[model samples]
Target chain A: MDTIIIDERIDVGAVFKKNIIKPRWFVWKGRKYAITEVTYTWEDTQGAARVMHFALSDGNTLFEVSLNLTSLEWRLEKSSVV
Target chain B: MTRTILLIDMNAFFASVEQAMNPALRGKPIIVCGRGRTVVTTASYEARVFGVKTGMNLYQAKQACPQVIAVEGDMSRYIDASHNIQRIAREFTDQVEMFSIDECFLDVSKTCRNEVDPQNIARAIKHTIREKLGVTCSIGIGPNKVVAKIASKMQKPDGLIEIREKDIPVLFALMAVQKLQGVGVGRHISEKLMSMGITTAGQLGNTPLEKLMHHFGIMGYRLKRIGEGKDDSPVDSSGGNELIKSVGHSHTFPRDTRDISIIRSYMMMLTEKVGLRLREYGLMGKTVYCTIRFGDFTSWGAQQGLKEHIRQNREIFFVAEQILARAFPLSKAVRLVGLSISDLKPRDTQQFLLKEMEKDTTLAEAVDDINKKYGVFTIKASSVILSEKFGIRPSCGMVSKQALKIKV
Candidate 1:
């Protein structure tokens, strides 16, 4: 599978319950993807900012998304077709 | 009571994590490595079937498995997964020793006394791990760490084997001497044992202690007992999990360079990172060591003693910089730079008597607070600007350097 890099900012729909941030759906390129499952999550450093990466599956596709906790921004890092 | 140690070794940890995250890669060949690194850090079982292996250069891995997909390793992902696995293992026994990021030894001796069967425990642990984490482990159960480690290798991917006390003689009779990994029977030691006509574990155990002692000195006595599949080493519950003997950081350059300025810049950056961690751990050190590995891979290093223990980044950098310069006048291009501090102790609680020193410490603490709230390196020293321009980022993988050297 070819991973197309998409280091682009996007709006995300998330639920904040009991201090847990869970993404329910995200709109990218005007297409809303309903996340079927959150497969994995991990964090890494980006300069001075802490980056939280989420591997989310949309039924048939896997998308890599990141949140910049410092700037409170969301990004679509890359995506692969399953 | 005989102890029962279970060695739970994950199967192709990094690659399995990758497969679990991306269903597309499931049941397919994959190799995990850094983006720029040419060597493969891990190869999935699918790739292993085609002769792909860890430490193989990318080209060689490609040759072995043309369809092998290369995935960049994310240290955070693997570390988090390892922690989760440890949590799961603790559900069965509290005496869990993390042998490595992908392996651990569980001392279920007490659990067994409660009439719990070791095999059932292993099976339950394996099932929970697969169901919850989507990864598998091979578990070896035995009377000691040595036999348990060897037993774990009998089956792979998802395997469990128990080596009972009664089975020792027959099982070890034909077993090669080198298979006893916990005893440190490397090529050097095993070759000597083979030369002495001790080809199998049984013969090694049968060898007279005096003769073995004369050949191997004090190590011979321990080797003979290990040959009989015996080891008394406990599965330490804490296992020095919180111990930070020394704080250090190292970076391998993209290309070897003889530029002194670039070398010092990197040293300063690494030193700052080390100091940040030392402060985080509330540690102070009185010794600094600098190491440089030339392009040829030969290494040179020297340690300097500090007049007083300190956690300030600049103070450690000056010592580390001087150590690096002492090797200088540049005999060769340097490929790697490493900085470490030893003689560590907790920072004193007393306030600094001098106003200047007090101000500096307070300022550093404030910077740390901001960085902790915002991000790392948010208030980095100006000396690291060159490194930043060179795209030297604070990486997650730096912790793995300290993690790998831990003894099982």
Candidate 2:
């Protein structure tokens, strides 16, 4: 359920819409992760959407779930986080 | 109708700036100078009450007021605050002349009418500087430039004095002769005036101009006119044709000493500072001058014109040191040593002999570029390090071979 809770907060649709998914690597409340999938809610609610993903650079770690924009406030983005 | 001119001088600019930033320094005796072994650039009015003053050696100032808090002078902050005050002055009139970093002359003739009070304008300037810049200034209003300058100094910080043309004799009666401009030129003339029982401006003004001239030549005629308030000098804001006339620096030691090594070391440091600035500004000078102030407050200056314009640190040091070598007593302790380079020319087109020296010229230009990009002290001569002194180290000191390209 906690993993599901984490999955729900990171909305893929909003991340893609705001261009925050690419080039971003960060930890949330001490959980290290990376964005892998972004999806849209609908055309009418243009900004509000959902996301599906895993944690890795160059497709190394496996994660799968659906997330909504209404939950998590934001995510971190950096030029080169290594 | 007599036009009123106001001269406003800020009290202890740098120290006051610090005090204004920090609430605790208010009413405290403070001297703003360089941290170790430097001249007191500005002394608070509290410190001045005890005979401490700007240009007095730090040790001498400490002798005058032992408890004075000495702060290193910050010219940048003072310049910022000065620009603010200058902006405020422009709100009143465009005819404002900056006399010094902390002093200004405002020609309010157009703004002030016959019945309109000049005191109101003085109070406005004072209040504006205090409220806006957190500093105070003394204002003096008089009929002419000399009288206005003297009147402004008559009062202390935040005080104002006004002298009208009709009241010149009355004002002259109460003031000493030294208070008049140009009266302290010679000792014998003062004694002669004293012998005649004409010891004040009023008495001197009463003395016929012809008799005064007979005693002191043309200067006597000038003195009589000054005594009677006949100064016609204008407040020239442009400082016309004085294009950076002389660039010089003087530093006072913590203690006075006659050691040639120490004196030469300080002069060398000063010479390098001036030389670097000359090169940075693309200027070279033919005339180099040196000044020495003794412990007794007596001073002497000597200058010589070089055969060619030079900007090298060694060249400036050599000329200044040579002058001092011939002029210095070698016995009397020196409190201050100053160096100035004048009669400047653009370094790019300077004529020179010797092929290697000309090559060195190109090298100097390249080094100047490096220093400008990476910051000063990025590149310096080995002689500068060999003759290292206890002053500013000349830069941020972060060395990198990679050139920092600054966009013009």
Largest DockQ belongs to which candidate?
Answer: 1
**DockQ agreement of candidate 2 with the native complex:** 0.01
Q: Name the regions of candidate 1 deviating beyond 4 angstroms.
A: A1-8, A14-22, A42-52, A59-61, A67-73, A80-82, B208-218, B239-243, B254-259, B293-298, B327-335, B393-408
Whole-model alpha-carbon lDDT for candidate 2:
0.66
The DockQ-derived docking category for candidate 1 is acceptable
Model 2 alpha-carbon drift over 4 Å, by segment? A1-82, B38-43, B47-72, B113-116, B181-192, B239-244, B253-265, B276-284, B294-301, B307-314, B327-329, B332-335, B343-360, B369-376, B386-389, B393-408
TM-score per candidate: 0.87, 0.67
Task: Enumerate the candidates' DockQ scores in order.
Answer: 0.42, 0.01
**lDDT tens digits, residues B1-408, model 1?**
789899998999999999998878899999987645566889999999999989797899999988899887767678767777778888998888877788888999998998889999999999998998888999999999888888899898799999999999999899988776545677889988888888999888889999989999999889888888788888977755556778888877656789888888889889878887788789999999888888777999899998899898878888887788799898999878899998999998798789999887888788877877766677888877776665462353355434432232
**RMSD in angstroms, candidate 2?**
16.4
